[model samples]
Target: MTRKPALAVVGATGAVGAVMLQILSQHADVWGDIRLVASRRSAGRKLAVRGEETEVVALSEDALTGVDVALFLVPDEVSARWAPIAAAKGAVVVDNSAAFRMDPEVPLVVPEVNPHAVRVRPRGIVASPHCTTLAMLPAVGALHAEFGLRELVVSSYQAVSGAGRDAVALLRAQLSVVAGTELGAGPGDVRRAVGDDLGPFAAPLALNVVPWSGTLEEGGWSSEELGLRAETRKILGLPGLRVAATFVRVPVITTHSLAVHARFENEVTVERAHEILATSPGVVLYDDPEAGDFPTPADVVGTDPTWVGRVRRAPDDECALDLFVCGDNLRKGAALNSAQIAEAVALEIGPGAGDRRGLGSGQGPGSA
Candidate 1:
C-alpha cells in the first residue's frame, strides 16, 4: 500500500485557514494524515476534517516535527518566524503570507504561471502571491504568451474579508447601524453614526467603498498596491515590467475582481485576446457585453477558477487590451493555491518526501 504524506496547516482556525481545511477534506483521497495548528488562544478547539472532528493545536517548533509539508495561512509576522523553523525541521513550507514573497531566495508562485519556480526553492519555502495578484495571473500569463506584455494598469475591487475577520465583523455591525437609521430614526441615532467606532478599517465599509487596502508606503501607494506590482513582476518573469495598481476594498463578503488594462509589445486585437483567454487554463472568458454577460463578485464568490469578461481594445491604443476578471479570494487566492504548491513540492521530492533536517543544513534552491 502506498503511504500518503503527512501534512500540517498553520493558522488552521482563521478565515482562509477554514477554507483550507474544507478544500483538503474535499481532496482527502490524495492527502495523507492532516494536522491542524493555530495560535494559543485557538488551541484545543475542534474542527471537522474528512468527516472526523480534529483538535486545533498551538503552533510550535515541536508540532512541525515529522511533517512532510506545512501550509501557513497565518499573519506575515507569524509566517516570517515559523516558516523558517518549519523548513529547518525538513518540512517543505508553503507560506500564504507576504513575509517572504519578494525575497531574492524565495519564489512567489502561481502554479499555473510558474510551476518551475517551485522546484528551485532552496529555502524549502514557497510563497503564494497576494490574493489580488493570484486572481489575475492566469489571465495575464495567457496574454503574455500570445502577445508579449509590456505594461499593466490594474484597479482591484477587493472584498472586506481580505482585511481579516475583524474587518468582516465591522462591516456587518456598520450595516446594522445604517439599516436601523433608515427605518425612521435620525442618522446620529445609529450606533455607527454616534461614534461607536471600531476602526478595523479607516472608514465605514457597510455601504461605502474605501480607496485603500494596505497602508501607504514610501511612493504614496498602499502596501496592497505594491504587492500587486511586485508579485506580478515576479510571477510573469518580468523583473522590469511597468505596472501600476490602485487597490480598493468593497463591502462584498468574498471574491476579488480586477479591471486590467494591459499594453503589449506587439499589437493585440480584442478578438485575438478573447481567443487566447477562451482556451487558457484556469480561465473562463465571458465577453458578451451586448447580452449583459460579464464577470461579477456574486458569480465568483465560491468559485475556484478566475472568470474573465468585458474584453475590449483601448479606443486610442490598439495594442492595449482591457478586461475584467474575478475569483474567490479565499479559495484560489489563498488556501487552494498554497495546497497546490505543497503538491508540486511533493511531486518534486517523490512520494516518500518526509525527510527532516536541522536548521543550518539541508538547504534547497532559495534558502537564506
Candidate 2:
C-alpha cells in the first residue's frame, strides 16, 4: 500500500465507462496508473484518459495484473462473468451491474449512505446500485437518518438512456418521426411510428411514458421497481421497510427523476427535511417554487450531486414527507459511485488510514 493505487476501468468504451474515464480525469491525482479495458474488438483502440491516450485492453488475467481497484461498468452478464476474474487477480472490484447486487456476500454500496458496509467484503467485490435507485437514495438517506424512516413510496421518471445507447437512438428516431406532428398524437400513433425500434424496452419510449421499466417480474411488478425496494432497504439497514415503487420510462435523454414519499417513525416537517437535505454530503437542496426553483433532469443532466426539490409534508400523513429528486443517471448513478468506492478503498489502503493491509476490515467514510 506504499505506492499509489493502480486503477483499471473495465468496459472502458461503453457509455458509463466513458463517463468513468471523464470522472477520473476531473478527479485525477488520486490513483497512480490508469488502465482502459474493453471487449476484444475494442482492445486495440485508444482512449484519452487524464489527457493521455491509453490503449484499451481486453478483460483478462494479464490485463487485471497489479490493479488495485477495478471498476466494472459493463452489462450484468459481463460482470457476472468477468468481475470474479478481476477480483481474483488482486483487484478490489467495484461492479456497476445488477449481477451481484442482491448477493448477500457482495455489499451494494452508496457512498453517501452505507459506506461502512464496504468493509467486510466477503468476495473482495462490491456492487453499485442500479442508476434509478440512485436518483433519490442520497436525499432519502439523509432525511431517513434524521427522521428514522419506516416506509417509502417512490415513482420514478427514468430517461431512455438508462436502457443504453440503442434505447437513446430509438428515442431520437421516434422523436424525429413525430417532430412536426400535432399535440394529441395518441398512444397508437406513437406505437405505430416507433415500429420495431423499441430496442431493449418493451414499449416505445418517445412521446410516451411507459408505466413499466425493467423486465416484468412476478405479481406484475417490474424489475426496476423491485430493485428500488430491495436496494433502499439494504442501504438504509431496514430489511423490513415497507416500500412501494412504480417505475416509468419518460422520453428524456440523461437524468433520472423520482417523486418520493417517505414515512418516518417520528413526524417530519418540510423545514426539517429541507435542512437535512441541504447539508447532506451528496444532495443538493433547491426547493423554492415561488422563485421557480426545482430540480429537473435537463437542468441537472451533467451534474454530480443529486438535486432535490418540492419538499413538503404529506397532508394526510404527518409522519410522511414528499420530495422530488434528479441526478445524472450515467454519472452519479453509475460511474461516479464506482469511482467513489475506489477512492474509499484507496483511502483505507493509503497512509493515514493506518495499517494498509487491513482493507477487509477497513473503516472510513465509504467502507460498507
Candidate 3:
C-alpha cells in the first residue's frame, strides 16, 4: 500500500492554528505523520490533533525535513522568511499570510472559488486571501460565474479576532472597562474608558466601530481594502475588474461580515441570485429578513460555510444586486482554507508516493 503523505502544521499554537488542529481532528485521517511546529516558546507544548497529543517542534529546517506538505498560519514576516525555505525543502507550502498572495509565481487559492488554480504553483506556494476577502468570495464567485461580474463595492464589518490574539485580548480588556456603564451615549465617553493599548487596531473596539483596519496605502486605501480588491480580481480571473472596499473593525470576536454590491454584465434577479448561492459549494443562502432570518456574525461563527442573506436587486439598476455575507474569519477565512488546499495536495500525492522531498521543482501542483 502507498503510504499517506506526511504533513507539517506550522504555527500550530496560534488562534487560527488552534482551529486548524480542531479541523484536522474533525476531518479525514488522510495524513501519515502530522508534525506540529511553532515558535521557540511554544515548541515544547502539546496540542491535540486527530485525537492524539502531538508535541510541537521548534521551527527549523529539520522540523520540515521530509514533510510532504507545509501549512503556514504564521505572520506575514514569519511566513515570508520561512515559507520559501519549506518550499525549497520540497514541501508544497500553503501559506495563510500576505507574503506571497500577489506573487505571480504563487497561486492565490480559494478552494470553493478557484480550485483548479491550485494546479499551477510555480513557487510551490498557495496563498489564501485575506479574512475579509475570504468571508465573501464564495458567494461572489458563484454570482460572478453566472452573471459575469463587472464590479464590486463592499463594506466589511471585521471581527477583532481577524487581527490576531493580541487584538482579541485588547478588545476584551476594553469591554471589561465599558461593560457596566452607560458610557457610549456621551461623546468622548468610550475614548476615555479604553485609553491606550488598542493593540493593532486604530481605536477603541469595544463599544465602537473603527472605519479603518489596516495600514494606509496609496490613494488613502488601507492595505486590507486593497488586498480585498486584488484578491477578488485574481480569484475571479477578472483583471481590470473595478473593486472598492472599506474595512471596519467591529466588536465581534470571530465572524466577519460584508455588505456587497455586485454589478454584472447580464441583468440579475433576486431569485436567480438566491438560487445560485443556495446551490454553491461552501455557501449557505439564508435570506428571509421578514422572519429575522439573515446571516449575522453570531450565527455564522465557528462555521465553515459562507452564510449569505439579504439578497435583492439594486432598486435603481437592473443588472446590480446587493447581498450580506458572514463567515468565520478563523475558519473559512484562514485555517480551513489552508487545510482544504493541503487536502487537495494529498489527493495528488495519493498512496505509496514515497519520498516527495524536493517535490516542488516547478512541477505541476499534482506532481507528487
List TM-score per model, in order.
Answer: 0.92, 0.94, 0.96
Candidate 2 local lDDT, 102-203, one digit each (tens): 999999999999999887687889999999888888998888889899998889999988788888888898888878876335648778865775787777
Ranking by lDDT: 3, 2, 1
Model with the higher lDDT, candidate 2 or 3: 3
For model 3, residues 1-368, the per-residue Cα lDDT tens digits are: 45688899999999999999999999987888899999999989988899999899999999977888899999999999999888887778999999999998889999998999888887788888999899999999999999999999999899999888988888889989998899899998898888977788777887889999878899999999999999998999898999999888899999999999999999999988988998999999998979989988988999999999999999999999999999999999999999999998888766543433334334323333
lDDT tens per residue, model 1, 146-169: 899899999988987877888778
Top model number, lDDT? 3
TM-score (C-alpha, index-matched) for candidate 1: 0.92
Could you say which candidate leads in TM-score? Answer: 3
Error of 2 at 304 (Å): 0.4
TM-score sort, best first? 3, 2, 1
Can you list the residue pairs that collide in candidate 2? 115-367, 115-368, 116-368, 117-368, 118-367, 118-368, 119-367
The root-mean-square deviation over C-alpha atoms between each candidate and the true structure, in angstroms, is 3.1, 3.5, 2.0
> lDDT of model 2 at residue 329?
97
Worst 10 residues of 3 by lDDT: 359-368
> With candidate 2 superimposed using the best TM-score fit, by how many Å does residue 80's alpha carbon deviate from the native?
1.0
